[model samples]
Target: MRVIEAPSPNHEPRAAGVPLDTVVVHYTGMPTAAQAIDRLRDPAAKVSAHYLIETGGRVLRLVPEGRRAWHAGVACWQGLSDINSRSIGIELVNRGHAWGYHPFPESQLESLRVLLADILARYGIPPARVLGHSDVAPERKTDPGELFPWRTLAAHGLAVWPDPVQPPAETPPVAWFQARLAAVGYCTPQSGRLDDATAAVLAAFQRRFRPKAVTAAPDTGTAARLMGLTASA
Candidate 1:
């Protein structure tokens, strides 16, 4: 991991006393890396991340890991808010959902594995705490999109992967899904119904662990995966 320092003036001091224990992955989502880099560096944009990985595997350092980069806005995870205060944000350069989302290149994934391992060593970020931008703010964002290689990350010991499980004949109720999602570290909706927010959370989970089915509507397979991951956690 040779990192190029490409500083951005869009960060602020992290909160007074917050332990940086989480890693949030995102996709640049612009037409090109240069445009995304410009947006991140522009102070008026009020957004930046600790680093950005280009498609060809070049790593650019935008903000110091010690400061808050204002990457996550209106996001939550496991009942915690103000995520930017306690997380390291890494933007993977890809044209996300809006611009014809595509699979991440092998070069990019290779560099991400190295970068994540280095950051996790310093902060001891847990596998379950390695999450996507969509994981924290499913209702507002989807980056490092469904096409991202989460299983590859898990194979490298950078994140967690659920073991295969047989789903019960009947799909679990929405309330059950909500409970299990919460247990698996998501900020689930407590409404006891299949609301959009809850569905978004479920989709995020599937994107991470069950990319085969991302319906957002709970199914037997989704339920089984959720149960397995929740139990493992």
Candidate 2:
């Protein structure tokens, strides 16, 4: 795949012996790609992604894969913090929720598919490890949000998508949902009640798997989707 060099200085060495096993996908929340790219490249911003894919399919490399980009700040996944050291961040050019949330273009997604395939193969990253920025930082982020076509990526083996399943005859409790979500790699709380933190994580999960309705309510459909994902996992 062709990529343009647009290196950023906001990176540092990864922690010793850390394997880059995760890929966190994000959308540039700025109104324009130029603004987003400029901010990422600026040292004062102290944030950069490994790569950025533009709306028209152009790929730009902002940080070397060997270094830890300053993305994924204050994020956690599967009980692990310091996600930036363990992940490669790819930013998609889109007016995210802050601007005008919309679907990703086919051109952008095509470039992402090619790039993701190459990254996964080279690093031995599993499809399950490919996640949205919201997935890792549920309470603080929503980019690469519900509009992202995860099912399309899953079709190409670049991501995970669960099949539809029937909800249990009797609706499960909050702890059950917590267990299933944690099993699916979300840093969900195991508190017996649906607390704020747990609700945020559940909303993030719904943003990915049940995009049509992200009410964050522990409804039957959401429960079934969680069941399907955990069973497949």
Candidate 3:
């Protein structure tokens, strides 16, 4: 619950009339926490997050919540492109996919749970809005990757986790999957084809909802999870 002030300058005033309603989780995809912190604080880098949690449960406030930190670059969510303007970005310290993908430590997750609870309550943001960086920018990024314990967060009502439902008896068409993904807040391809864009989005979706196998194909389990989320939404 202790937050150390370590402000970064790579932020700007949010656009007028934009409601802060989302929280994007990310991993500091660097070799070490010091390197990540240095880059985030470096004005030349021009990227930062509101908070950065180290592996040992230390939380650093990098950018004030009132300003738009330049974390979510070239991303879209639920049809909105100005994600940073309406979201608080939290970066978890980890040597992400580029270095060595691994499970987040228990202490780190514990801090995340505590931090998320406070942020969600204060901003009135829903659990559904607690999204991963990959969820928002599927094609370009995948931090806070598959190994992150989303189910643990869902248990605390901080994030959404779909119930285990049987995969559909038969596979549905690409268009069917497309509509449900859109409904579930993904900016998916609507071209009705299983193109690379659609697959990237599906892979990102699976990375969150069905992490065991991120096949990127419109498989039965992925489709079922998509259906379940869309129905609940």
Q: Which ten residues in a row have the lowest lDDT in candidate 1?
A: 224-233
What digit string (tens of lDDT, one per residue) describes model 1 on residues 138-231?
A: 8888777778888879888898878788898999889998988888778998799999899899888887777777888889999888777776
The local distance difference test score of each candidate is: 0.88, 0.93, 0.92
**Candidate 3 stretches greater than 4 Å from native:** none
RMSD for all candidates, in order, please: 1.0, 0.8, 0.8
Better of 2 and 3 by lDDT: 2
Candidate 1's TM-score reads 0.97
The number of clashing residue pairs in each candidate reads: 0, 0, 0
Tell me how candidate 1 scores on lDDT: 0.88
lDDT (10s digit) by residue, model 3, range 122-233: 9999999999999999999887889988888999999998876778988999999888888888899899999887898999999998888988889888877876777756
Residues 1-233 of candidate 2: C-alpha lDDT, one tens digit per residue: 99999999999999998788999999999999999999999999999999999999999999999999988999998899989999999999998987898789899999999999999999999999999999999999997999999989999999988887898887789998899999998999888898999999989999999999998878888889887787767
Name the regions of candidate 2 deviating beyond 4 angstroms: none
